[model samples]
Target: MDQPWLKALHVAAVLLFAGGLLAQSLAVAAALRNDISPGVLARLRQWDQRVTVPALLTAWAFGIATALDNGWFGAGWLSAKLLLVVALTGLHGLQAGALRRLAFQAGRPPRGLGRAPAAVALALAAIAVLAVAKPF
Candidate 1:
């Protein structure tokens, strides 16, 4: 694929993945406070499985491809962006686990989990800055 097209796809996938993470963060936070119906949770899970996870994978794949094509490996900005991306990916795993536990059992999420949305937003903003500025 052309570089520009690859970049566009990567951007689109990242947007979708970020939106999914935000949605999951809100859903899990809401589940912590009250009783959301299993049916609704099920639907959200379906969306995550069908849309969110795929977007995440696509983002990763295209991102790696773009970096390799451009010889960006070992660059400071890419390294920082990669760290943030890893953190976000791990957060998604936690969110998915929380959703499952909430759907299956009656319990609250771990403390501080409610602040995930803010953390995600902060990390995402930093990632954008690093990617755009490439300041070492």
Candidate 2:
């Protein structure tokens, strides 16, 4: 399709993916303190599997499409943005694993996971700057 629409979809998908990761991060952090019900964790897992995962995949697909369409493959800013996106994606996987462990097994989340939300925020901010400014 058109470049503008493609970019818009990519942005929308990224927003959804980022929102999901933030929500998951908070939930995992909460699990570290209070006892979140297994049912709630299950619901979160369902949401992650159905909505968040798809959104992440969509974001990747549309992002690559936009980059190809714009011939931005070699841009330094794009590379930096992609690195942040990969980090976010990996963070999502870790969060999902933590949620599963919390739901099925007993114990606190892995150390340092409580700080993931802030990290996600920072990465997202950096990504936004790179995307908007394209500053190398």
Candidate 3:
């Protein structure tokens, strides 16, 4: 309920989202060469459904809570950070789609998706800068 604890939980959610995305990205990349093994695909699906998705939702929920709690919704820097968060959310959607496709792959899973994790990393870095510096 307190601001500090709420912010800490938001950060933890962000970290969970990032880690899950990283693992999913790597797994998808591996699937590009060959069909992901059923076992691996199952695990990946479970992670996506149970962990990754929930973490992302939690991050968004807590982020909005923090922003409104602290009266930060109208700041220029927050707008930029929100844009980056949208980007991250879009990437998350695409990754989820790719993972779904991987589940149905007969062979030769999708390629050119290896860049997703890197993009997420970049987005996260930019968001961190905006949050810390609020330079706008």
| All-Cα superposition RMSD per candidate | 1.2, 1.2, 2.0
Query: In candidate 2, how many Å is residue 39 off?
Result: 2.6
lDDT of 2 by residue, 1-136 (tens): 9989999999999998888899899899888887578788899899999989999999999999999999999999999999999889998998998898788786678878989989999999999999999998
Off by over 4 Å in 2: none
Candidate 1 lDDT over residue span 86-121, tens digit each: 999999999898888887885668867889989999
lDDT of each: 0.91, 0.91, 0.84
Q: Which stretches of candidate 3 lie above 4 Å from their native place?
A: 106-110
**lDDT (10s digit) by residue, model 3, range 30-127:** 77766558689789889889998999999999999999999998999999999988877887787778878767763444566766667777888999
Candidate 2, position 33, lDDT:
81
Q: What is the model-wide C-alpha lDDT for candidate 2?
A: 0.91
TM-score of each: 0.94, 0.95, 0.88
TM-score for model 1?
A: 0.94
Q: Point out the worst 10-residue segment of candidate 1 by lDDT.
A: 29-38
> Which window of ten consecutive residues has the lowest lDDT sum in model 2?
102-111
TM-score of decoy 3: 0.88
